[model samples]
Target: MMIQRYNVDQQGVGQFDGGKITEQKPIGFPGEGSEVKRVGPLFYWAWAKAEHEGYIPLHPHQGFEIITYVISGKAEHGDSLGTRSIVGPGGLQVMQTGSGVSHEEGFVGSDMQGFQIWFEPHLREALRRKPTYQQFEHEEFHQIDFHDGVHVKEILGDDSPVALETDVHMWDIHINHPFIYHQQIGKGRSVSILVLEGRGRINETSYEAKEFFVIEANELEEMNIQAEAETRLIVIEVPTTVNYPLYRK
Candidate 1:
């Protein structure tokens, strides 16, 4: 078992639209100065917020699966596929830029918060497929409330409608103070956890908001996380390696 931690100060920072939009990248592109770059198929992850209102001009993407998950407020998307859509809080906008596609983004409302994450598939196969776009409301996902003061919302995993070529599992979790959340990691897999709110402890080590943790196991392992205070986290699990060739930075 291996666990790596990255504090907020150690993450990468970025801005857009003259700083109208600010971002904290847990995993950024190469040379972005993030402690962690690509992890398995998980390429990039940015937690962004609109100070006021912001817009990102159309940009092209190819051979990657992009997901925009709105944490609060609203996000509008316009793509070269002639798709224009808006998703409110707890909604998601997914773009499979299989071959190639251009898209523009707009953040509506003050202090709008969201996450834009990129996942890589087999590039050669992805580049040969057609691009597509899809959207999902928050209620469409499977949410479970555990008796132990833990709530989990499945984003991309079992019982989720969102589908991509990448083999990954994602969840939005909230744990009440003094509660514990346990997770099992299968062999040859890794789990990345990002604290979005509150504080927590893992094996006597404390963690707070904006912190990222990566845990990998060569053999099946179990992890126990206890919430020091009310805490919210996003966790993604993926294979440690793939059979196909990976893009090197």
Candidate 2:
């Protein structure tokens, strides 16, 4: 088991939306200048910040499940499925581009921050289903408040609105003060953490804003995460038994 950690500077950064949107892409598409991709069905993990309102024109995607979580502002979404809506802070938007889909997205405020994660399903099985979309608000999910100044928000889990056909658990944790939180992963499950704001120490290693830490399945154990200050982070735990064929440059 191995734990891999990456700071924001170690990840690939790019500017889009006419340079208004500066993105730190942990994984990106071909020809996009990002090289970080996962194996065994998980393709991309990205955290983006939009300093100003802007749009990414209609683009086509297929054979992937895209999950969007808005952290600060609102994002207007429109897709070929005739879905048009706004996902605000603590809101989630998911699009399963089984066969294929075209969509457009735009930030809605002076500062919009969010995460866009790409998860892959069995390609053969996915192509047999039509594209679909699911939306969920913060209230629709379960929130567990710990006595140690830590709050865990389950975004995609057994009690969440956005259900996936895959075996994955996604959570958002916000620490209002100095505290530690522990999460136990199953034997065959891998865990990944992305820090959104503030600072923290994970496994004796201190991490600041926009850092990502990945723990292999064999390394699954209780993680000691202590917030140096008010901190917010996202965690993804998934099965490591499956192999995902990724597309890269």
Candidate 3:
């Protein structure tokens, strides 16, 4: 087992709309200073917040799969495809920038919070496909409650409604005080975690809100975690190695 940790300040930072929207990036673009650049097919992960309101001007992307997941308020999206939509809390805005696409985003309501995650597929194949956009409401996802203060929501995986060409799995987890959570990780895979709220311990290491970590297992393994208080986390699992070529930035 290999474990790596990065505290808030150790991660990359960015802002849009003159700081109205700020981001703490666990995995950021090159030169942004995040300790971890890209994790397998998972390229970028930005946890963003709007203190009051903010907007990101139209930007172009190509050959990347992007998902905007709303955590608190709502996010309004406008794209070159002439699509206009709003995804509220617990919803998702997905975009597969196949050939190319230009999109703008706006944060609505007080203290809006969300994540913009990017996943990569084979660039040549991706660039040949047509760009597409879709939205999923909170109720559309599959969620399970253990009745022991642990709730698991599937964001992307075998049973999830949202599908992508990338080999990845994602979950949003919440655990209450004194409850333990366990996950099995297979060989040749890595698990990336970002603690969104509360305190917890992964194995023997303690962590708090805004902390980022990764666990890579060379063999089959199980992770034991305990929440010292109410805790919320977004977890992503991806292959440790891919046969396809990755972008060099």
Candidate 4:
């Protein structure tokens, strides 16, 4: 299997919320000063941090499933749909902009940290549907405690509050002790590993914080993750086929 690593510093950087929010974007669009967009079917992966309470103005999106996971502090979300809510640490917000939608965001407290991930579906089918939103607290998720030092938390899975029209599986893993985790990717499936904290080895390559490793289905077998510290990571598994055509404006 081929393993590619992307360090945190290699990601594109942007400041928002009057410079209160600093973002590190992986898989950003090419060229300078351009809004980061998806390559292939994946839209974007952004890690944002707020120095203090702040807000991002209204913005429009379509034909994509947007997911936000809070790591720390609180995040307040409001949209044109008249939905307003606050998501604190370990909370999740999923917005499936099947056709189109507009939304705004704000941060609370001295430090706010979170991740915003975008996934795309078949464009033609997506535009035919209406947008929807779903929210889940950390307590609603499935948490597996391996008292032996391994824990697996299902953030989005087969039996989760967040649902997607496409075939995708996402999880957050926390390991406090030494252990090996395995995942089998079927044929034509793609797997991406993003390390949020600590260090780990994937296929013999060491990956540190903010590093992403994308493994192609045809190039690999199962995946093995080993932690060198109390590690936290987000994994996304999806099919390799281009089931959707992205619309860029």
List lDDT for all candidates, in order: 0.91, 0.80, 0.93, 0.78
Clashing pairs in 3: none
What candidate 1 gets wrong by more than 4 Å, as runs, is none
Better of 1 and 4 by TM-score: 1
* Candidate 4 local lDDT, residue 219: 50
- Candidate number with the higher TM-score (3 or 4): 3
Please identify model 2 stretches exceeding 4 Å from their true place: 30-35, 243-249
What tens digits encode model 3's per-residue C-alpha lDDT throughout 147-249? 7879999999998999899999999998976788999999999999999999979988899999999999999998877899999999999998898999986
TM-scores vs. true structure, each candidate: 0.97, 0.92, 0.98, 0.91
Shift of residue 38 alpha carbon in model 4, Å: 4.4
Query: Candidate 4 lDDT, tens digit per residue, 62-152?
Result: 8788888998998888898889988899999989988899999987767888888888788788889999888889999988887677778
Misplaced by over 4 Å in model 4 are 32-40, 247-249
Q: Model 2: which ten-residue window has the lowest total lDDT?
A: 240-249
Across 69-183, the per-residue lDDT of candidate 2 in tens digits comes to 9998887889999999898999998999989999998876668998888887777788788999888887888999888778999987787777776667899999999888777
User: Using alpha carbons, what is the TM-score of model 4?
Assistant: 0.91
| Candidate 1 lDDT by residue in tens digits, 122-198 | 99999999999999999999999998788999999878999989999999998886887888999999999999998
Cα deviation at 140, candidate 3, in Å, is 0.4
Most accurate candidate by lDDT: 3
